[model samples]
Target chain A: MENESFYDFGGPEPEPARPSIGRLSTVVANPTATGVEAVIEECAALSRSLDGILALIVATSDGMLIHSTWSEVEGMRAAAISAAALGLGQRIASDFGQGEFHDSVVSTGDRVIGIYAVGDRHVLGVVAAAEDVTLGLLHLSARRTAQAIGRVLSDS
Target chain B: MSEIDVINFKLVVTGPFAAGKTTFIGAVSEIPVVTTETGTSEGREVKDHTTVSMDFGKVSVADESQLIELYLFGTPGQSRFDFMWDILSKGMLGYVLLVDATRPETWTDAAAIKAKFDELGDVPLVVGVNRGTESDVDKVVAALRLDEAVPVLACEATDKESVKQVLITLLINVVEQLEATVKGSI
Candidate 1:
């Protein structure tokens, strides 16, 4: 079921630069094992609290996965790359001390998620299955997950 | 149009919190922009600021012999949030410091910023004083530390022609600097 979510979208959504959007739709309803316990618990809570799949991952700035949920397919190494891109974003933010970059979302092919800087060296990434999850909800959840990841990452 | 000659240089668009940096780039940008815009929190929540990181925009302009590309990265203008300037200023050709014309005191801050740009060592700078009104021109020019030589133009942040003027001045100054460098080298 990881790549078969073609017809489930809300009509015809525009494509995105990243293929993960459509890929997520296919695997969203897949049987996930709940990768990281604490994060998975938070994800479960938030997912039930809101409306979405809730893909979350914590990883090193260099793209090494530190922790993740069952939502990931490519797993650890892929998380690392996501962290690296988040790092690039942090570097950009650090370039101006514009303040530490928090989160970003790419909504395409019926996928809406925010990737954020969580800890000293880790990034917290999340995805929303339902396209209707408002920005307010997204930011709220992203902020909560970021704080959670910060605590989890600091210990590691 | 030779695909090999494309030089996409980056330009940072920066200003104070409500200074229209977002709208400025939006007005002139040729493509559908990608923005990381968050919502407003009135009194209960604090202002997280527009640019926690840099906002990027790309423009492609074509001519007979060449296609000049410009990439604009808008920086957050909070002075307290300047820890990133040291790295952001690296290899930059010039900067456009958008000053709010009504606030003359912001000129001292502008001087401080020019000093910051000067640290980049001979990088050119052009001042864009957002002058929505015609009467606000003189104070703005005087405040930006523009003598007779520098380019200090009044601009509406939402106007494309005004931005073009600021850009043209920077280009001319850069050309002059290159000429001077070649002459000194020779």
Candidate 2:
């Protein structure tokens, strides 16, 4: 028989921990490797497929930029902001009893930024021209790209 | 003006990576903490997940005079997230710089962080040495090159009572600073 404490009465058991993807180390350790190249190619393909999209950035959950169409400094800053926004979105969803968080969109007068989860370990940020892109089209395109990116990462 | 019913203060808890900032806030906060934890690639050997954005928690101290609400904000320790430090420190009443006693190497990082926060504001600061004894206070002060007025105290981040003491000590310092400012304006 298992020893149970009074304090443990009727409490839900904790979920098992998920394994870390170690994506940051893998990309940093060998940027030119096949797997890293595949992720970069995915970002490039996604950018080419969308006309209104201005930039596409793929970053680790911890805000390290894996690939981006933007310059290095701008990409790094966007990646950090993406991580913070993703974290805040997840927390708000959980707190309000909303279902699993999918994506978040920030719209301005001239531009829109969409942050989406790529699997459990990475985030994808898409910046687009608000005048040229509809919210629905941006969502559909970004969601598909995010899924493809997730597959590439999982296989890698 | 009528007696103030509620007063809110923003307090930041910051230090080097894995210095128990999250645990310290969770120990004292009345609400469920909002944490932006993500898998760490660089420091995976030390800890699996790290705070990429920030951690938020809240506690209230009610006395006969007024109700004080302390909003605790914990920052990501890595320099890459240093931008969050500035964003979080805006309008902060004061801050607590927690350092891990077991890892003296991180004290240098702690010192650098202290210097950054010092530039951010003239707010009061208290250094809490986690997993340390009373004897560690002196060493921490000397290593951090802290001012003589900064209170350095040993604390266990996991202990509620210990965490409370650290906050209370910082609150006392904050009060003293406010008093000094009011007197100076006269």
Alpha carbon lDDT of each predicted model = 0.56, 0.74
The residue-by-residue lDDT of candidate 2 on B27-123, one tens digit each, is 9987556677889899787799888888777777778876776768789998877877765665566899999999999999999999999898788
Candidate 1 per-residue lDDT, tens place, A29-85, comes to: 211223234544555566566766545555544333344553223333335335545
* Local accuracy of candidate 2 as per-residue lDDT tens digits, A5-108: 10121211222211122222212222334556677677667667676777777776545556766554445445545666766666666667576668989887
lDDT of 1 by residue, B1-186 (tens): 334354334455665555566666666766444344554443124344465445445565556655555545565555755644543443455667777776665567666766676775466677777864555656766655566666677788788887777766776686577568779999
Over 4 Å off, model 1: A1-156, B39-49, B132-135
Clashes of each: 7, 0
**DockQ-based class of model 2:** incorrect
Q: Quote each prediction's TM-score.
A: 0.52, 0.57
Lowest lDDT block of 10, candidate 2 chain A:
A1-10
